[model samples]
Target: MPDDLREGRIVIVGASLAGLRAAETLREEGFTGSLTVIGDEPHPPYDRPPLSKQVLLGRMAADSAALPMRRDPDAEWRLGVRATGLDPVGKQVLLADGESVTYDRLLIATGTRARPWPNADEAALDGVFTLRTRDDAGRLTKRLAAGPRRVLVIGGGFTGSEIASACRERGIEVTLAERGPGPLVGALGGTLSMLAAGLQRAHGVDLRCGVTVTALRGNGRFTGADLSDGSRIDADVCVVAMGAVRNTEWLAEAGLAAGPRGVACDAGCRAFNMYGIVTDDVFVAGDAARFPHPLFEYQMLSLEHWGNAVTQAEVAAHNMVSPEPARRPHLAVPVFWSSQFGLNIKSVGVPTFSDQVVIAQGSLDERRLVAVYGYRGRITAAVTVDMAKWLEYYQGLIETAAPFPPGPGAADGRPLVAAFPVPSNVPDPKGLFHGPTVALTGHLPDRRLTVVRPAD
Candidate 1:
């Protein structure tokens, strides 16, 4: 190992969960380098998951969700200043404040921001909001506390569903609209999404599926919304949960493979140049990185899971300091969890990457079950609804590439039978209205490709 690798200037953009963890990991790996973390936000890194759940419900203060530092990296922080551009060849990051920071190694953990509503005028309405930052949560918390007559949520993804759930928990009337068949259909399959729709409606949520909010009809403040189905919803508040946009616009001319999908990277978390060539100095992690996963047929996965941020950051940090022979791949299976409508939905692996799903344990009618997803007869992912105890078992199955429909006598003590398998309902990326928390990007492996070719 070269001593220089562990003792050089390492600049990390996007002082976020991934960035913070990477800084800590670098220090833990004996990297005595000069570390600098730049964040556009004025506040320190905070936990975003709670912003939609506990914080919005008033169970926890929005500002109190600040992420606890495991150990100080002893690095300089450029808070409230955005990274304007990247000079890869020059090894420098241009800041919005007209300053440039030079670095030997750069970590692009810029992450993603909430996608704003397309209509600028309507989005600027007084009661309209989007949840992504700490301040956004705090402002929405105040609005929720005011007890609006009704809350209209524009999208039915996880964030929208959670927001609707929080509104309902506050005993506030909430209407959720989804362009798809149901909530979470883009991530979990149609079968589970049907269950999700039922769950939301059962809990008094105005679940409006297969419809989109065509326009927000508001003057100075939010007054109502017009749906595609020719129905008008009268609500005082409107939340645009249309998903997130990766923070890669600043890297547009940086000669990196970055765009709407995210910055392309390798399994070791090394970033790729514009020509698809891997660069040694520049690396990326978190929701901003698209990396290939062998378990999912080597498809590039762009994940927004908290677990991925921490694990991938550590892997990136380790690889940045270690020699090539000792480098390890960031092959950890993706995991995501959401609490809405009194159900704890947790998924192991990429459910959207699979083609078929089967209810292995319990029943969907009972709302306590483990659904396993498979691709080519192999288990690829599992989603547990109020059955999280079996999450570890399913995770192991995914890690080992266990056969679909699984065998009997597993953790739950239920006979694993191949129930009717249904299409996973993974939507086309082009038509999607929201970005999924776990996205299987890039080309899927060709199942028919063989090593030997028949002579034509």
Candidate 2:
């Protein structure tokens, strides 16, 4: 490693999980230069997964979810300040407070924010809320504890489902409205989502599928919501859990390949310029980065999973300090998990990228099973319900690109023939309000380019 690479100024844009981890890695890699981390929120880096689970359940406080740092990076912390824009040409980050910070190497770990309800006026209603940050969780937590008559949850995504579960556990009446066929269908596909829908209803959730909240009714405070199916829900509180939007708007004019989806980057975490050329100094990681992976046929993937963010941030930090020959690619497979309705659901690989699926083990009737997904006769992904112990076994199959309809005894040595394969039944992403945890950004053979061109 060259001394020049180790002693340059480095700036990280987001002070969340990925940004914190990347800063720690840069120090561990022996980069002794000046480091700066900027964040719009006033608080330090914190864990977010618990905001919807433990915090909402009253087991943990929102402020107590702070992420423990492995080792102090001894970097400048610019909290409560927003980065208005990026001057890639000038190698500076423009701040909202009429200031610019310069850096030799830049890391955009801005991540994502909760997608709020579209209508501004209705969203302003007192009881309408969207959970994303610690403040949001704190506010919602107090409301849930007040014991509303009925809580209205719009969208059937993981966050919404978890919120619904929390409401039920508190003995509060709640209604869930999903535009899709069932909850979690957009991510886990039709088979397992059916199981999710059943769980919600059995637990006393007013599960309404194939419906959208047409309008939110309120008079200074949330009164209820009108559904697309011509039905109205009268509740004191309404939570909009549609999905998340990547925080790439600040980089819009930076000449990077950034848009509503996210910033485009190479597998090595190098950011691409507007002209599709990779920039050596600018890099991306966390939910804001969309990078290609050879395991998924070189498709650009934008993952919102915690594991991906941690691993990718480390790779980005390492490559940022190492020579070209020593740099490594971020190829960690996507993984995500959620707990709702007394069930622990875990997934490995991109479940939405497959065409067919089969019950490799257990049975859905028992509410415990491993569903394997395949694309073009090769294993692509797998989801386990209360059977997470065997997740690594299926991950190996996916990594090997094992044949579909995995033979009996593929994972377990016991003689149990796998069930016949069936269509994974992944729905069109356009119809759902919730975004999948792992999103395949289409087939981009030449990831260097912004758009795929026809072969001559």
TM-score (all chains, Cα) for each model: 0.95, 0.96
What RMSD does each model have against the real structure? 3.5, 3.4
Give lDDT tens digits, candidate 2, residues 353-442.
899988877887899889999998888899999999999988888777788767788877644334578788999877887877777876
Which regions of candidate 1 deviate over 4 angstroms?
A: 1-3, 416-418, 444-456
TM-score of 2: 0.96
Worst 10 residues of 1 by lDDT: 447-456
lDDT, model 1 = 0.88
Off by over 4 Å in 2: 1-3, 414-418, 447-456
Q: Write the per-residue lDDT of candidate 1 for residues 1-456, one digit (tens) a residue.
A: 235789889999989899999999999999997999999999999999999999989999999978889999999999999999999888899999999999989899999999999999999999999999999999999999999999999888899999999999999999998887788888886889889888899889998887878899877988999988999999999999989999999998899999988999988899989888899999999989999887776788899889999999999999988879899889898999999988899999988888888888888888998999988888889999999988998898887777776766655666754457878887764444556678776653432342322212
Error of 2 at 201 (Å): 0.4
Indicate the TM-score of model 1. Answer: 0.95
